[model samples]
Target: MIRLDYPIVIEPAPEEEGGGYRARVPDLPGCISDGETRQEAVSNIQQAIMAWLAEARNLGWSVPSA
Candidate 1:
């Protein structure tokens, strides 16, 4: 199992973009997620972070630290 912590950037999603919230892990390029609420966005991003790490590991990519 691999565990890593990365800083997240959360911002309000644009109306045309679904009007929820967007969360992204800056340390992991292209790792992003969205949800209807801030808390939800955070939760979703946490899951996304795990998935990102898992994929990175499988692909033998370098994982960045927080």
Candidate 2:
């Protein structure tokens, strides 16, 4: 498995519901993950990025240059 070692930035957004944190990675389009807590949101984003990269590689898509 080819692993990509890069950095991802996560920013907090105002929650539409009662309360929570929203995370988004600018470098990865449509790559947004959120959770009730800031820590959780960031952690989920990392998992999301890993999955995205794996799927992209499997589909023979060009991995976005960070």
Candidate 3:
């Protein structure tokens, strides 16, 4: 299993982006999560990271190393 401490960025969503907090892994393109609260957004991002890694593994993509 690939273990890495990838950087995570969480920011408040803009009005046009829908009001909520959004978390994203800067190193992983298209890996993003959003929620009503900071905690929710963070939790969702954790799941997103796992799913992203799983998909990458399934497709034989190289997992990024921190």
Candidate 4:
């Protein structure tokens, strides 16, 4: 299996925003996920990365390297 690593930025949700975590992959443009905890956010982001790669492949889009 080809593994791709991308830098992710995880930010805390503002208190007004309900208090959770959000993770975003900068290289994947719009590839993001969120959850109620840091662990969940990271896990969700990993799933997002997989989905993003799959969609990119389906559309014949270029996949960037880590």
Q: What is the lDDT of residue 14 in candidate 1?
A: 100
What tens-digit string does per-residue lDDT give for candidate 3 at 5-64?
Answer: 789899999979888899999998899999999999988988899999989989999989
TM-scores of the models, in the order given: 0.90, 0.71, 0.86, 0.91
CA lDDT for candidate 1: 0.88
Give lDDT tens digits, candidate 1, residues 34-57: 999999999999999899888988
Model 2 ranges with Cα > 4 A deviation: 1-15
**Best-to-worst lDDT order:** 4, 3, 1, 2
Best by TM-score: 4
With a 3 Å backbone cut-off (N, CA, C), the pairs that clash in candidate 2 are none
lDDT at residue 58 of model 3 (Cα atoms): 97
Worst 10 residues of 3 by lDDT: 1-10
TM-score of 2: 0.71
Report residue 55 deviation for candidate 4 (angstroms). Answer: 0.2
Candidate numbers, best TM-score first, in rank order? 4, 1, 3, 2
TM-score of 4: 0.91
In model 2, the worst 10-residue window by lDDT is 1-10
Runs in model 1 deviating more than 4 A are: 1-4
Candidate lDDT values, in order: 0.88, 0.73, 0.89, 0.92
